[model samples]
Target: EKSIILLPRQNLEICSRRSSRPLPDPRPASLPPSSRPVERRRPPSSPPHLRSIRPSTRPRPPPRKSRRRKNSATFRRSPFSVPRYRPFRACPRTTSRRCTRNGDSREKSSEIFTPSCVIDFVFRWGAFVLTSRLAPSPPVPRQGMPGLGRGAKGTVYVVTDPSEMLKVLHNEGTHPTGAIQYQWPTKRWLKDVRSHLGGGDAPGEDHGFWGDGPKWKRMRTFLQTDLLTPRIAKGYLPGMIRAAEYASKGAPAYAEPGRFHIFSSRASFDMFSSVMFGEFSRMANPGPETSERDRMFCDHALDAAEYLFPMMSNPRELFWSAVGVRTEMYDSFSNGWKNAREIAMEKSYAFMDRASEDRLEGDFQRRSYLANALRRQAEGDAVTREELAEMGFLILSASLDTTSALVNWLVLHLALSPSTQRTLRKELTAAMRDRGAETLVPEMYQQVRTLPYLHAVLRESHRCTPAIPINVIKKNKASALEIHGETIPQNSSILLDSYSVGWDPEFVPQPERFRPERWMDDAVEGRKGTLRQVLDHKMYQKPFSQGARQCPASRVANFEVLTMISQLVLDWDIALSEESEKSVRSFQDVPYYQGTTVQPVMPGFSFTARS
Candidate 1:
């Protein structure tokens, strides 16, 4: 038996199954010459599968020479043919086969193999999943929704959800790591400089601010127990009041009218110097002939420390420094460190001498941070002179900038919100009147702290304009951190966006509006509740951060700011100068910048003594 299959548009031909003879060319008589198909015979030994019991006599059409000239209408009109541009659709009938174009082949089959449909489906869905997992999140507007993002440093997990943030921090086991500490940039730069100068590259044990492990613990404990405790912090009240009195006296003659930050900075330095080093800084006092030179040098040093970290961290600045294009910045940084170190050393020596004499005379009343450290040293503690100097510098740097910035921001907020300022003054007046005090005195420090409205304003200010916008980078070491439903890998850098959480509507209703009332118990009505209730709802306010590694001077900072604000509001009426108002208005228009902190850049304001 023999069989033959008729291909589409092919000419019909015949051959005997038992004979190997070639079949005659069988062109159909009715077909045109150009449309006729060529004919060929199958071998006698052809496979049985290729053989057919019967052969069709119809002739097949000629092969397509070029598809470019073919009528596209035919394929478009045919239900079996797919358009080249459109995605391939699955055929309705699985058994149906049609002569369809398959790349360059012209063939007939029982089923068409179209994997493009599956590929198209997977590509579209797979891309979305991958992008969501890997890509950085979008920018958050002032009043926009919050989400995760990425930066040059590492992954930035921005959680606007207070509860979620609390969970992450709460579970951040002891020794929670934060973004590279501010000190690292300068430290690394200095280390490189030392290495280039033929110093060994071997790492030394970190001490003071940047130290971790045992050293960090010891330093933190010493600070908490001996210096920053509430009692110890309160002990600085007399010094703080003196600084405030000096600031009030010199408020009128400061370099600029509304630039009260100058006074705040000087006052903070004076208070910190007196409390920590047992010497008063005459920085805020007016002089006839450069009497404030040392104070100015101290200010320059602190400013240098601030700009040094940023300059070192900035690649462009580093590049410029390397090529000697901008040597001024490098010189400025070097001078700043040198001046600060010299000052720290001088103060350390003075304290050591005073402490030794005090110990000989049995005079424990002159106790100061330096004196206490000296006492520890005398008791055979391992504290070094270099360590003491470093700690002093760190304390001055931390206290001056942070407290000055906070006081500046708080006063700015009050100046902008006059009604809020009036309310605060009223509260202060009532408290003072109740105590029959005409002026804020050392004894009234405790009373001023208890003023609910004043404290609320401070809390609200800290929340809205966190001194450190994103808490220092926190690192998880033990296991992967789970936030929301996503699992952050182990040892990943965690950045809690305090700015985002501070403005989140869930924790703070009308977050954009500056309303101290939101924090008052009497103001908690309608949909919004009291500040305590809100804090209870999600303990989200972490201005000083929450952990063992939290800022050690937080209580002292609070006391300093509270005392300054009380004195200023009690004795002076503040309002933004015209230039200051314009600057503040512009700040409102575009409120944020990505940097070490995210707080309002306020304008200067004039202060008038209250009659």
Candidate 2:
């Protein structure tokens, strides 16, 4: 629910003074609240990203005269899951080598983590670990740690106190930090897991986006000097609109509507892939020639995800160099990279290969940003072939899941609130009429930033059910600092409590409510309670991210999501599936799922043409 911004200097100073020692042993979940005041400290480096959360020095205001609510009501913890991994679609966009039950084990783990946990954790943690005991047979459990609730088998716990989750990355906070059993570091994770970071592995100098020191400075320099600016991102608008049209119908039917499970995901995949590739291939029905290529790219990404799922639960020594299985998970992981590289080089390199010789724009000034990226690399921008491979894979993986989730949620939310849908449609109607846009063609396109209602819908959907429902890791330079009186040792991991942020009542009035109006008011509701996730919402930052390292593709993604939903809103009416309606009525229910994006699980809806 939250990305990061800079924490104030006072807050950092407090964090700096408190962590001179290792953290204490884990505390009971029901441990009594701390009585001491939270002091401030200086963290290891310059101020870094923080939730757009406004800090309060005074005691929070009491509930209104209408009624008071219990704190417990506000802090309903989101359910927990088993193992977590950086999704295969992450920056590296490949499965972790430890995706089987043959990876590292903790003293506490015996049985492998549950598949539900495996699925959930993989979405949240970016990586999860397990032992051989995870096989169908029962195994062992860790000492002193009693299972918390149902589904507590041999899972691992990363302590997160919301406020100090980043401290864990530094090993200065609670719990212990572990390794990314399926690490793609190409080497072990070299950047300080606890230090504020830039993507060192990002194929250039370390400091790419957010500023830290030299490494981060270089990153900022390169991106700013090259195509990373907002203007350049806006250049993709034509392609974005083209992608939406293609999803509607064109080349090979993208995730045929009747295919159910693959529908939403394939559509978004097409959209994102088009963005990365600089053109939309008609997704009507893959011709034999392109079908294999599509699978090699998208399918490889998902298959890579599935293949690693079970094997990762098995502990490491178990894989044992015995079967001659190397520490690297060549079977599941390597294939994705291998397949992705071949296809990307074939398709994208062809683009690059051709663009490099074009007369007009020297590739760098070409309309296609990717072509420009190749040109930059050629002109000493510091990117390598390996980085480009991951960049393409990341394009598929990251864009696929998020756009799919956003579209599905948009429709679901629209279906449930006819009035809201009506309001939204009115806006789209006027915009379309005013723009006089013709047949939403493949190449004819425009921007949508001025669409206020559209922005609200996307923000509200993100707030209610964030695509990522849990932690985001941050590593900083120097040593770790303390936060909220807890000592965050260097080299540890921290869990950013997004679930808590979304539900914090003090920040959003009627925290459980889904009102977009809170953001419309200018002054952010006048205080701490005013912050919300709505675009105009005082607390609203780009849901894509906040601060320096905010996602580079956010602008393009925003246009794609808005345009896709706008087209649908103007063209179709989404009605709830009877089953989905029934489940929405019940608190304990699951919906559809598109691969790992965890959607309405089986959400059913009928789309009717609307005038």
Candidate 3:
């Protein structure tokens, strides 16, 4: 079989999971040679504020170091630690073939990978069993469906043609927008207690998903009311800056030899926690009650998250079909739920109380999203206290995972494509200079808002490897998505698979390659008119989402990513991990086949600070 096949690879003409491929190289346009050619040493100039710091003002305790050590879990080192993997709450967007957890995967999953989900009243659906597991590209598209092809996700998908995809998103297909039908899970599978992954919730209480579709809908509304505003996002900048700083110059513990990373999976997780939750996390630097609380909460949350997301078409059906059991993963899930409930409840109530008290006392701040949520709740919008909590919870969970996922890819790009990295650094440096500064602190914040190169990097990173492989999934309930001329059916979930469109040659010339400049100007080296037009036109719909259901915190996410990159570029000269960067063998578990939150899957690279 040919090494590469068209996306959404079904059982036909597919290769085995053991197959390996190379990692993606950064596009030529984004990183200019002039930028990468030169090298800089000496740490990036420290924040002027840090340099001016004086000795500690707090009085030190007398040397009473004789205290005996207690159980380590007694105090946590950080505030934001949560169980990293949750089950059904959020599905992995990009799934790959099975292998040892080492993440070495064949780079074959396509743009619209769909898990094979079929329930005849009840049964657990294995996400695997794709075309790679079966035959070849020799299977052509079915006549009526046009563009419908098979791959990992499902045997038959909607349209494979990029043009048709856009039409669907714009409501143009005969199938119409919102025409897809979603399915309910099976009863037999649900009857099996082993399949249930319950979490840390009070016995018999409705923890969130233990209810109905209306609950989710209201929670969705609550999220819309509070999180999407610009005000809240602006307040979160400090978190991104802090995380970026740590990444560029890591803690003393992990900064070792040739492949040490200032920023790793941990950094990304921590950064997001700090920004979204304020200072309440226990993972910041554990060793207290907060630490223990944070750990238990995160772990439990992940456990619960696991069973929350199953590709059964209808999540509600699955929950009701299966009785909550106490299996190992279920126990973990239950604990996670308990923790998530506690945290979300605490934060949600606090937000509501604060916002309410402020308003009642005639001391409310200016208009903002939180106020909107409050208003919705007041107007009987079903924006319950728990629902509000879920909103904050989603921000923490979604933003962090997606952002970190993208960062992972960015690091891989830098390591494999030094030239591209250098070029980006130059553009960034020029932007900094234009701001009349050589330092890496306060002023840089302002610089990020205006830098074209910085924006280019952010956009290009997304263009090449969307932080979340799956675009927003919108379920059309009332009716089908009626497009330009056609009418899609009701109850259909329409997904604008940005991955497919991003790789489409028409929208993006040489779709597979990375090209930041393509977004800035027309394709220079034998390509199309311009990538920006495609992006701006919302080609095949945006990965970040659009309209009412778009990502509320996009602005903040963008700022955080840009700031992190700016600081990283300013602070260090980085390259891919020596082992993983080798061109001969491709990276294992690259973006193409990851399930849900699929992102860059490479190791840390070598780095040295710029003086």
Best by TM-score, which number?
1
Between 1 and 3, whose lDDT is larger? 1
Better of 1 and 2 by lDDT: 1
Task: Give the TM-score (vs. native) of candidate 1.
Answer: 0.65
Cα displacement (angstroms), candidate 3, residue 223, comes to 3.0
Task: Give the deviation of candidate 3 from the true structure as CA RMSD.
Answer: 16.5
* Per-model TM-score on C-alpha atoms: 0.65, 0.59, 0.57
Q: Candidate 1 local accuracy as lDDT?
A: 0.49
**Between candidates 2 and 3, the lDDT winner:** 2
Q: Write the per-residue lDDT of candidate 2 for residues 102-168, one digit (tens) a residue.
A: 2343233222222222224432222332212111122221111111111323233232233233333
Q: Model 1 over residues 162-265: C-alpha lDDT tens digits? A: 45555566655655543334343344444543421112223664533344545555655665666656777777777766667666666555525324556667
- Which stretches of candidate 1 lie above 4 Å from their native place? 1-153, 166-174, 178-182, 189-209, 255-258, 287-293, 317-331, 359-365, 441-449, 504-510, 523-539, 579-604
- Worst lDDT 10-window in candidate 3: 82-91
Candidate 2 local distance difference test against the native:
0.42
Off by over 4 Å in 2: 1-228, 249-261, 284-291, 307-330, 357-366, 385-390, 436-449, 504-514, 522-550, 578-588, 592-600
Q: Report residue 545 deviation for candidate 1 (angstroms).
A: 2.4
Error (Å) of candidate 2 at residue 413 is 2.3
